[model samples]
Every structure is written in C-alpha cells, then in structure tokens.
Target: MSDKKKEIDLEEIIAKYRPVVGFRVKKSLGAANPDWEDVANEIMLNVVEKIKKGEFRGESSIGTFIYTITSRRIVDYIRQKSKVLRHAPEPKPLPSPHEQIEDKERAELIAGAIKKLKPKYRETLYLYYYRDLSRKEVAQKLGISLRRVSERVNYSQKLLRKLIKK
Candidate 1:
C-alpha cells in the first residue's frame, strides 16, 4: 500500500483496537498499577507507528498485529520493572587530630634534613626522586659516573635519616 493509504488505515486500526489493547494491558499489568494507562497507550502507539512504517505486511489482520505488539511490550515492561539496583561503596572516615599533627612534624623534619645536604647530593636526590629521572640519566645530566649517582642517593638517604633523628 501507498504511504498515504497506510497512514489512514493505521488511524482506523487504532480506533478499532483501542478496547482490545486496553483489556490486554490491564489484564497483564493489573488495573491497580498506576502505569497501566501508559503501557496501553504505548502499545497503541507502537501499533500505529509500525503499521505506518509498512511493518504490518498485510499477512495478518490488524487485531493480530496489535495483539503481538501488546504482549511483547508487556513482557519488556515487567523485565524493566523487576531489575536490581546496584550497591554503592561507603566513604572513608576522617583522620584523628594526633595523626594530622604527627604528619606535619614529620614533613618539617624531612624538609630540614633535605636543606642541610650538600649541593651535589641534593641535586642527585632531586633528579632521581623528585624529577623521577633514571640513575643513568641523573649521572649524564650531572656529568658523574652511574656508580657515583647510586652512592650519592644511598648516602644522602642515610644522612637524612641521621639528621632527622637529631
């Protein structure tokens, strides 16, 4: 059928199918369900839209076509309604005041120790740790041997520990 003719037929089909569609939806979803009207309306809308789009194919009568659409839509609605809600993770609690003060004091001790290191050891540590350079890269940048870079990093760590202890 032509598009214009199909559109007319669809409207007539909707008018005739309205009662059957309402009965099918109300029976399946129950009249007490607040969304019964919405589901019934959705089925009718699907029937009209599919018929207009030439999905009917003229093989089945309009009643059968609407019946199939209503049944499938009801199944889909139930599946959607019965789905599970996902669980959320709980948030972490705040740290105690003692932890906050200890963290601040430790940070101060580390800062003082770093400032007391000689310039070469400080440069080596800055490149290797803070700037995240490889030992070879730190050696090449500082014009020192790889062995010298490793020694400086280890020795600086020992010195910092001693200074912090004092």
Candidate 2:
C-alpha cells in the first residue's frame, strides 16, 4: 500500500537495498522459514516510507538504515511466532457416547446409594463429598461439632461403599 504513495523514488531504493535486506532476512531467519521476496518487499516499503517521512534522517548511511529496518523486522517476526507457539490453546476432546452413558450410570448408582443412606449419613455425605464442603464448613452448616462431622463422614463413606456394592 505504501508503494502507491508517490512521494519517494521507491524503485531506486529497491534496487539499492533489496539484495542487502533480502540476504540479511534469509541469513538471520533462515531461508526455509519465510519467503525471501516477502521479507525484501516489507523492508523496501518501510525504508521508502521512512525516507519519505524524514524518519531516516541523514545521520546514518543508507546501508545502515536498511540493515536496521531489516533486522528489527526479522526480530519482531520471530518474537510474534514465539508468542503464538507459547500461548497456543490446548485441544479439547469430545466425550464418546459410550463414555457419556457410563458416566450417567455411575451417577445413578451413587444417587441410589445416597438415597439408601440414613438421614444423618446422607446429610454428612452430601455436605462433605457431594457439595465439596470442608469438615469445618459442614459442621458449621449442620450445627454439629467438628469431631462429630468427621465421624459422620467416615461412617457415611463405609456405609455408602456397602450400599453401592449391593
């Protein structure tokens, strides 16, 4: 797009800097990584725009200016690629119908086991395991002592195992 901006002699700049910029990009980023033509074109466009806008003040030689732009672009490209690789999302697996069925059956079995439990044991199991509450939290919620909550949870697990086995 900047090539269409007719303020500077783009052809002269391309002729002088294409080889230097292209070679630098290929050598630094490896020829196998990206198309050399694309890198060369980007460098040419940037240099042309910078010179036109007076950003490339006469403090540095033309070669140094071209090299700086080329090197910075290459570095930026690599950093962007590295970030993409590092933060790439993990693939999620879909559950098979068989797995879903088995999970449902397991939930039904646990529900039946919990239903068979006495009220105190059922309350303990529901709060401590199903609701994922800590023993102290369960005790506070049920207005019971911490030791009583712990005892109930231990007894409820044993009772649940026996009920599920049947």
Candidate 3:
C-alpha cells in the first residue's frame, strides 16, 4: 500500500483510542487548564507527525507509546506556563545618582582590565561573556573549537582577575 493509505488507516486507529487516552491524560492535569479535546488533538497530531518521520521505533506497545507521549506533552505545557509565570519581573525603584556613578566606575575598571588581556583572550571574553554568545556560538564566530573557546574563557577569567587585583 502507498504511504498515504497507511497514514489514513493509522489516523483512524488513533481516533478510536483518542477519547480514552485523552480522558486519562486530562484527568491527571486537573481542571482550569486546556480542554481535554484540545490536549487529545495535540497529542494525536504529535504522534502522527512522529510516525511520519519514522521516529516510532516500535520498542513499546501502541497504548504505552500514546500514554508516554501524552504525559510528556502535558508536562511540557505545564513547564512552559510555569517558566513565564516564574520569570515575571516585579518593578524596582531606580538607583540613586551616586550608585549609578559607582556602577559606571566599576564598568570602566572592568573595561580597562579587559583591554590589558592578549587579543585572543580579550576577543573570547568579549564575545562569550559580553556578547552573551554560547560557547558553541563563540567557537563558530571565532573559527575555533568548542574546547578552545572554553580554554580561552577560563584563562581569560584568571588573567582578568590578576589584572584587576593590581
């Protein structure tokens, strides 16, 4: 049979099990969250897509597979929502002029110490820490290996500490 025919058949099977699996997963999530139908639809969609991609290795029963995927998807949803809620920033009072001036001086001192570093160390620090690039990204940008970037960052920190202590 053609792949399309297989997909339609599989989809029908999934639909047959949807209500039972959806009810089980939804009950675990309690009330006041996404509706059961929506969660079930998303779980079915995910399973279907994974099936199409040949990601189902057939190491587990179909029911077990559905249960694991549904559980993980629900956990992922909770984590995503919790992340946003946990990171919600509260307002803070502005710093005083004296505090601002002190911060500026500290930044200037740090900059001067950075300047004293060798070019390799300086550029690595600037890109990885100042620019907030990941180590892999820094390696790509600087044409170096991930290990080399890590070495540079570590050595630069030590060198900067020595320089700043003077």
Candidate 3 deviation (Cα RMSD): 17.3
Q: Candidate 2, residue 96: CA error in Å?
A: 43
Every model: Cα RMSD to truth: 26.2, 23.0, 17.3
State model 3's lDDT: 0.80
Give the winner by lDDT: 1 or 3.
Answer: 1
Model 3 Cα lDDT, one tens digit per residue, 88-113: 84354444689779988988988899
Highest TM-score against the true fold, candidate? 1
The per-model lDDT (C-alpha) reads 0.85, 0.80, 0.80
- For model 1, how many clashes? 0
Model 3 ranges off by over 4 Å: 1-5, 86-166
Clashing pairs in 2: none
Candidate 2 global CA lDDT score: 0.80
Model 2 agreement with the true structure over 6-119: per-residue lDDT tens digits: 445567678877888888888876765544567778878888888878787668887788888888898887787688769894354445689789988989997888898899
User: In model 2, how large is the Cα lDDT of residue 157?
Assistant: 78
Question: Least accurate stretch of 10 residues (summed lDDT) in model 1?
Answer: 84-93
- TM-score per prediction, in order, is 0.48, 0.45, 0.44
Q: Which prediction has the highest lDDT against the true structure?
A: 1
